[model samples]
Target: MMKLWGRDTSVNVQKVLWVLDELGLPYERIDVGGPFGGLDTPEYARLNPNRKIPVLEDGNFSIWESGAIVRYLAEAYGAGKLWPADVKSRALATQWCNWCQGSVYVDFIVNTFQPLIRVTAAERDSGSLAAAAERVGKAFQILDPALAGHDFIVGDELSFADIEIGALMHRYFTLPIDRPALPDVEAWYGRLKTRPAYQKHIMQDWTTMKIPGA
Candidate 1:
């Protein structure tokens, strides 16, 4: 059996959990990081040098980084399910996955999520939050057209690309911020919401991460 280390509330960790469930793989999850506070230990450092929440141990092999783990699992287990069989399709999936990490993750988590949820309302900078919202909105605008006719990021099927990008949608829609019209993206998100794995992992309560009044 595989072992996963990370708190369930973590979005990054949630991505891994979602994939694991989607693939119908059974694994033990040990809570760590955030309030659990096991990340700084020497034992934990050996698993992940960055001291991140998620670390997957599959027998003697160990992997860190959510995106890498997702890809590894998909290729090793999911085959045609999550990992696209076609070379070009796989490339396109990877492109979107990287795009999510490079563009959406930074803007959403670092700029928007941290400011609004982690920080208290009094100390929060409205201007910076607004700017972050705009940046995130613009990022989604690019995605909107791509999803115009497609149900998922790559195609009609749920792939690694959707797991990477769609994981952030719950927060994006739930957070108190002004969002521009994104019909296609909204429709795509709606489709994702209907999935049991997505609902179980991605659409989790996050009030604990927020300030009292925020």
Candidate 2:
């Protein structure tokens, strides 16, 4: 049986959970981060040296890094679906996945989310937060046009690329901040919300993670 080590609150962990649910792969999920903190233990370090929340253990093989784990599952299990068989389509999907991790996640989740949600109003830097939010909006501006004629990134259907990027949509929309009008991205997000797997994994309430008076 496959075992996933991470708390469900993590967007990265949600990415894996969404993939597993989409692929219809059954696995046991162990809570092990944030409030459940076992990541620093020696036993846990053997699984992931970085002490990150998500670590996929498939029998004797163990893999960390959420992006790498998602790619592994897509390649190993999702052929025509998430992985995409065509060479050009596969390459495009891969590009979007990398873009999500490198560009989107960095600007939206790391820069904006961490400071806005985790830091209290008294301790937070308003200027920095504003800058980060502006950067995130610009990042989405680049993504908005890409969805002009498509329902999903890389293609008309859902793929691993969507899994990676869609995982952050809940947070992006839920954040208590102003955003520019992005009709195409909004439609794309609406489509993602219709998926059962996405609803189950990515559409989680993040009220608890928000710092008081933030």
Candidate 3:
């Protein structure tokens, strides 16, 4: 059986788990990182030099980095669907996947989410949060138009691009902050809720991550 090392609470780890569940692949998930606190060990370091939460072990082969792992799984198991066998379609989907990590995640998740959930009220910086929110709004404005006629990121069918971007939707909608009304984005989010894999993994309760008054 395949082995996955990471905690359920981690967003990066959750991405891998969601893919696994979507593919109907059986794997043993070993709790690590955060409160589990096993990421710094020598054995874990050998698996991931960056000391990241998620590490995928398939027999003797090991892979780290959430995005790479997701890509690997999709290529290895999910063809003509989640992986997108067509070259042009795959490229388009990959573009959105990269966009989510490179652009959306940095401003929305790293800056806004980290402060609101991880940092206490006393330690929070209002200026930084406001700046992050502005960036997030701008990012969503770009996304809203891209998702105008498409139910999913790439097309009508679910793809890895949807998996990557959809993972952050729960936080985007639920977080206590002023948000511009992007009807297309909101409609896309509603469509995502219809998926079983997304419902099980991405739509999980995140109240524990939120600090008081956050």
Worst 10 residues of 2 by lDDT: 99-108
- For candidate 1, write residues 9-32 as lDDT tens digits: 999999999999999999999999
Give candidates' CA RMSD values in order: 0.9, 1.2, 1.4
Rank ordering of all candidates by TM-score, starting from the highest:
1, 2, 3
Better of 2 and 3 by TM-score: 2
Provide TM-scores for the models: 0.98, 0.96, 0.95
Please provide, for model 2 over 1-214, each residue's C-alpha lDDT reduced to its tens digit, 9 standing for 90 to 100: 8999999999999999999989999999999999898988999999999999799999899999998899999999998788888889889888888877777778787778988888888998888877888887888888899889977887787888888888888889989877888899999999999999999999998887887877
Model 1 spans > 4 angstroms off: none
Candidates ranked by lDDT: 1, 2, 3
Candidate 1 lDDT score relative to the true structure: 0.92
Native-to-model Cα distance after best TM-score fit, residue 101 in candidate 3, in Å:
1.8
Per-candidate local distance difference test: 0.92, 0.88, 0.87
Candidate 1 positional error at 149, Å: 1.5
Inter-residue clash pairs, candidate 1? none
Put down candidate 3 lDDT per residue, 10-48, tens digits, no spaces. 888888889999899999999999888987889999999
